[model samples]
Target: MYFSTSTLLLAALAPAAIIASPVDADLTPEGVPKITSISFSGNGCADPGSAKTSATVLDGTLSTSFSTFKGDSSSNCQIHLQASGAGAGWQVALKEATYHADVTLKPSTSLSFFTTSFWSQDASVTATLKSRIDCAGSDIKDSVTVKQSTATPVWSQCTGDAGYPGILNVNFRPAVTGNEGAYNVKSASIKFEWRKC
Candidate 1:
């Protein structure tokens, strides 16, 4: 078969054109929300000096060292995160969260950790993990991860206003008043996922 130089050049460029085509808007890097600011509140972080927050494009984290988080008491903390880049016709949601802690529990004591997350103008979801000790002098260092179901994802509001930020609340509650226990929350992080509005 006879092929012209122009024809061969067009064929050679066809594959490149296909490769350079636009990808799915949902898969774009811009869909990933960036955490612009973070703030901490509540009794768990009462000493603001003991809490720290850091953020990235896809996730945000809060770490705290508690001095008074001890026996028969409950501590609570609220994390406020301002997410940007998703305000442009995009919405974000909490895909998953991980909580890590170091706990020492006396016999017949139980500890529970709860996390609730929500965005402005959105409903919240809570996840909980519990630990119990039957033996004395029990020291536990562990982490729990909670994943949101894709079928019922709680998405952020489609608003361009920066005033609306995501909120995450954590509560640590201990049971059995007679026993002594200590809890130190090492860190907690939430991974965000986004989609077109």
Candidate 2:
């Protein structure tokens, strides 16, 4: 129903009652990440200090799947680990296989990044934690051997507390000889804390 300006003006003189409810308007699915830490969801280049992913550039750059970025299963992305370069360091599973990086993240104190999807090499997958911030950078946070099953790729994770926080990158290596398994990596995450700097 439409009301005339004068009619509406008269209504203005009356006391108005207000109501509040959980409207769908305030509810959003893509709200800022308040989980263990922030995860990026935009930008072609997971730029320095930015947490997000863009489909086109990320797919091309990291050689990873777009499943996670599409919010498919909340996986965010999967490593689909490779065995060919297990010992040689991280090599592309396929030409398309790449890293989904969380860059230039500031830590309040000690921070941790967990791998929801782990790397597997038949029976085992050797994990290596590397600081991708700078090659010269030292301090490998945590690395260990992750157990795997033929059916599911196990998620063994590493943690990097804030030593300096320029940038840190994680890498998984081949543990057993000729394990020839696979690195089905997924749900790479980050967590931050304060150190009272």
Candidate 3:
């Protein structure tokens, strides 16, 4: 079995009145925000070298591939990301996320995928997405999307911890039960929205 995952971060800046000056060090040539650092943990990435980021900060794109990621019974991975270039008085929020996967399940077998995303400062403002498949046979493709509420968006810390990057933690779990099955996650992407404090 072969499993690979990649993450792409996209940002949309709010109105000019809400956004301050851009942080030169955190922006790419096109003025887009960049992911400065990313770390992975959990049983899915037990091998130190199995997971790696392929894109650089200058690319304004961050991608990770897992050479040995597969789900037979259960597998989980946690990803922590810190981004820069939102400006001095602005903060980031997770607007949406989409995950794609390919799975194969025998009769009476089922697979479930669950994801939880939240900012480090406040866990109350969190978003989650769950998907389940039952006896889907071989070569089944799946995709799930989770969107946050716009009326009451959860913003990152803006004042108390000034200069600290807005942090987002995402955890993904794939579980299988009943008979036997195979699951492989293809990719996942996150979209960010920025606003002033």
Candidate 4:
């Protein structure tokens, strides 16, 4: 009887132990958003003479600017970020992007004696996803065009790669007339979401 009781107890405990086994450590973290890297590319946005250069785009500092001016030509400036990956070795989903900039025209170059300066400039920005860690869906992309002289924020949505880390590219452009006026971009950033299993 003693031997039979001991055997039954051991069997009961064995199943419990197996059921309580530890889960894989790799899949522990879920839905964590992280920024991997950031880069800048442009026709002349980084040039020494341009107002806003690649400095702000590369630096981790958000809501800041390397140069106060950002607009010289349409589609001449581009800022790219390799984000959407968490520290747990998994990729997150890119949701949206926010651009921080003060779209005010460069200080008037018109003579002080001039009663009125028709010099005006506007900024038009766009966003797109170049590549993804996994080619599982349509590309994520969006755009926003605003005309303002004060510091205002704009946003773009990620419509692609709903399950993997991807590249986010943003373009900075300025429209000007009547004079050599330019616009400014202080900073740009991306938002990430937890990827689904």
Candidate 5:
């Protein structure tokens, strides 16, 4: 079977579940960007005892956050974004990918943005294929670590040659195998250049 690159990428992402729909009712044609949905393998709170679900990250409010339970030791999640009328699965020229994190959160968590659709870093198996899926930009080349205090969210702005379908996948996982701690995430947003498709 000759599956196109887009086909393969979408197939890979199909199973992971869509963590957040980047645009929804909260987002009017002119309103603060809002996350629409969120999908996860297992969601809980960083404190282990705190009862918080992944929904906290998509509420469009920084007051709350999403965190993995303390005992899990490892965590992975994905967030998807597209313009209001980008048309399902349409490619979008990304400008920025932003997310908030607590300063105390260790560097163990890394973030990666994909143009097409993908589940994990492993999905970018070959260098050739990896480049295709990777959104090329000075701030986007490597796995982005959570920096800037919770008060200051991490924002990776796209410098050049950012091209991908309306579907942008923000994937995150702890850097270490046993990185047991609060993988706290406040919110995620993607800025795309809107154009008639």
Candidate 6:
């Protein structure tokens, strides 16, 4: 009876063990990071067709810039934890991904890749932010484009093998005028974890 019960418990725990990896361990070639929640530290708002500037999209050094949207600067430019889609999310600590954390990534374990998206309520409107993580800590350079769909934000990302770790930062580069859709930069942020095989 005891042996049978032990076998059943081990079988039940097998899936979780396979799914969960040690934070500092190397990731499988196909393993991917599991994110239960996300957090945004800075908030900056800007209206369309305007030359607005914000520093929230920056890292600790406050380097990244925004020159598109024009909105109340005071209203935005703040940082805090917010929900991804639903208010009740996983953990802000993991979401508030600072460069400090990325820099401290396990040296030879796994790599981390990040991406973002843009969302809008108006179908006729569009916006985008491109992240330049080329200089970030990683085994190789990775780039991600955050685009705003019809009132919704969607994202796509890619990464290299081995392990990438370092400071991850993104920038929002606006396109020329007379574009099809008119949109503003609503938000800019980042989250990171190991990209398993």
Highest TM-score model number? 3
Pitting candidate 2 against candidate 4, the one with the higher lDDT is: 4
Question: Per-residue lDDT of 1-197 in model 3, one digit per residue for the tens?
Answer: 21222322212222112224432324322234566778888898778877676654423333456656677888877788876654466566554444455566677787766666778878777765555566644543343222222223355787222334467787777788888878776555555555545
Candidate 4 lDDT by residue in tens digits, 15-134:
111313232323323333344555555653566544333332211232214353355333345555554423334322223334433332233321000000010111243223221011
What is the clash tally of candidate 5? 14
Which sections of candidate 6 miss by over 4 Å? 1-68, 71-164, 179-182, 191-193
lDDT, ranked from best to worst:
3, 1, 4, 5, 6, 2
lDDT of 2 by residue, 41-135 (tens): 23221334322332221111222222222120112222222111011111111111123322221222111122332234322443222222111
Count backbone overlaps in model 3. Answer: 0
Q: List where candidate 4 sits over 4 angstroms from the true fold.
A: 1-31, 47-64, 68-75, 84-164, 177-180, 189-197
Q: Mark the regions of model 3 whose C-alpha exceeds 4 Å error after superposition.
A: 1-32, 55-62, 136-154, 159-165
The TM-scores of all predictions, comma-separated, are: 0.59, 0.19, 0.64, 0.36, 0.32, 0.20
Runs in model 2 deviating more than 4 A are 1-176
lDDT at position 192, candidate 2:
19
Cα displacement (angstroms), candidate 1, residue 152, comes to: 4.2
lDDT of each: 0.46, 0.22, 0.57, 0.31, 0.29, 0.24
lDDT of 1 at 152: 33
Specify the poorest-scoring 10-residue window by lDDT in model 5: 126-135
TM-score of 4: 0.36
Worst 10-residue lDDT window for candidate 1 reads 7-16
Which prediction has more favorable TM-score, 1 or 4? Answer: 1
Candidate 6 RMSD to the real structure: 22.2
TM-score of 5: 0.32
Ranking by TM-score: 3, 1, 4, 5, 6, 2
What tens digits encode model 6's per-residue C-alpha lDDT throughout 1-197? 01212111111111111223333323222332222222233233243323232333211222223333322111222222112211111111112212111111111222222222232222232222222122123332112223221112221122233122212223233221221211233333344223322
